[model samples]
Target: MPTADPASLFWFLFLFATFVWPAWERQRIHLRRLWKIHELQRRRGTRVITLIHRQEALSLLGIPLARYINIEDSEQVLRAVRLTPGDMPIDLVLHTPGGLVLAAEQIAAALRRHPARVTVFVPHYAMSGGTLLALAADEIVMDEHAVLGPVDPQLGQFPAASILRAVSRKPVAEVDDETLILADVAEKAVRQVQDFVRELVADKLPPDRAETIVRDLTEGQWTHDYPITFEKLRSYGLPVRAGLPREVYELMELFPQPAGRRPSVQYVPVHDVEPRRRRHP
Candidate 1:
């Protein structure tokens, strides 16, 4: 190999320092700026959208994203609470048709005893068991048209009204033993639920006011699906406020109302069945 010339080496060094190195450094700075820009966008975007529900499907293929609360929802609620910062307040956006009374009570109890304040925001409706939990919040905020329904316990698939109606329409001795027993249980369940509702509201309302609200909700004065409007709840003397934050409606739009039934398979292609021939030797 020929020995390197000083002139060639000098030119090479000058070109690297003058052009190549500057381009390389400039590219590196550009990359860093791009990273910061994306990072800033990600940070700001988090405030507008909930990061916990980044994907509609997180895990458990059949479970809902955030549609409603049921007896099965305790684990999800606990997980949400665990993931949240302890110092931050818990804001529950409720829109449910209610579920198991016990589960609703557990959720309500958690809200009542949380270390930080709990606020429930109802976008559309939170009925039956949903109303039970709303009572536990320090502040319940709702959209103008949002509703909270009665907390009358259901007997299996039938409403308590069916059972109560039987008792009201017929004398005790005239009714069958099994029917009488069921009616008694239903009456007791209604009373117990009313008392529980009162207790849940007592934290936010005075004892007398709480009693009135609970009585109205559980006395079967309204149908189970009744839309106890925001204005109606406010008149009941609970600390119910109208006008929810914008974020609540934004989140509501994110979830489509849950469809309980699986969609039926719409189409089936016609095909002929093949028959095998039997040979007798």
Candidate 2:
């Protein structure tokens, strides 16, 4: 048998440490996340699915890439929903900045048809399409400070409402053909979302109340990036509650945002605290 050169052995080990180790570490974190998800499932007695889209630095230059609800996400979620028994409840941990409306609508429609209860957990914020998905849930579980956002459609880079507003301010002939076309599409988009939202909440709320909810969310009452706080959602009579499972929070930790050169936010991880008593004056 020929003996390997010492230099070749040393370089092999060096390359493995530099490249292979990171891949292995990532796999370990993935497995840990799965374990946490299973633990949450056992505690809640529901099938747990996570639609978490975190920004990650995937390139050598550490350029952060954003993730969102897309066709692939919708496909996977629909598959998971189908695999679950009809009688089994679903707990969806949703953390996204929203994505394609078409994909989101597909997911929401499937969840609406599910026979068992569907709960959406928002550990942070779920905007646009994310909010659309939450609307399908029987109950929305949010962190006290978590937020939802308007579902008004976006036409390219502009809000559909904004497009219509701009066109309405100008005379029909003054508007270019392209602008008129966009305005037409915007009108239809807004109406389509309003009708869909009404359908989603019809079983849960009275007709008048459901219409109100639909208008507030899909009629561009607020900016597309507006944060609908827990309190505001409650004021609207949405079936939203505060409090998230500890396991869910732990799971979020495993899907961390990509680290920059220096940490943007940092704090000591103090688990529990007792308030300090004031001395009598």
Candidate 3:
């Protein structure tokens, strides 16, 4: 038998450490997440599913990318729903900046139709289409600092409401044919979102109150990226509360943001403590 050269062995070891090790680490992380998810399901006596999106390394090249709810996401979530028993409750941990309208609507519709209770937990923010999914839930549990965003439709980069307003200000004869066509589409997009949102909350809220909430959320009253905090969400008469299970927070920790630059926010980790008392003079 021929003996292997030292250079060949060194190169093999280097490649294994560089490629194989990282792959193993990622698989380990994935398994850990599944274990945590199972624990949450066991404790809550419900089927737990997560739709978490964040800046993470993607592909073998390790390119960092941010994700939104998409058709693939909808497919997986719908499949999960179908696999669950009708009587079993669903606990969805949602964290996204929103995504394609059709994908988000598909998820929302499936969740809304579930026979068992549906609860959406937001540890951070779930904006735009994310908010649409929250609206379909029977209960929304948000962190004190977590937020939801307006559901106003955005046509390309411009908001549909803004397009309508701009077109309304101009004389019909002065508006270009392309602009007029866009405005028409914008109007339809806004109306469609408003109607879907109204339908989602109809049974959950009084008719008059639901109508008001729908307008505020869909009429572009706020910017597309407006942060609707926990208090604001409650004020809108949404089924929202401020609190999260410890496991939910633990689950979030498992999905750490990708490493590259230094974190923008930092602070000492401390829990509850009583206020310091003033000493008597």
> lDDT of all predictions, in order shown?
0.69, 0.92, 0.93
Q: Taking the tens digit of each residue's C-alpha lDDT, what string does model 2 give over 1-281? A: 99999999999998887679768878999999999999999998999999999998884467899998999999999999999999999999999999999999999999999999999999999999999899999999999999999999998999898898898899888989988988999999999998888888898888888888898898778999999999988987889999999998999999988855677787866655566799999
Every model's TM-score:
0.65, 0.91, 0.91
Sort by TM-score, top down from the best: 3, 2, 1
Q: Which portions of model 2 show Cα errors greater than 4 Å?
A: 1-14, 59-61, 272-281
Reference-based lDDT, residue 93, model 2: 98
Q: Candidate 3 — what's its lDDT?
A: 0.93
lDDT of 2: 0.92
Give the per-residue lDDT of model 3 (tens digit) for 1-281: 99999999999998997789878988998999999999999999999999999888874567888899999999999999999999999999999999999999999999999999999999999999999999999999999999999999999999999999999998999999999999999999999999999999998898998999899999889999999889987877789998899999999988988855688997755665566899999
Better of 1 and 2 by TM-score: 2
Q: Rank the candidates by lDDT, best first.
A: 3, 2, 1
TM-score of 1: 0.65
* RMSD of candidate 2 to true structure, Å: 3.8
Clash totals in order: 0, 0, 0
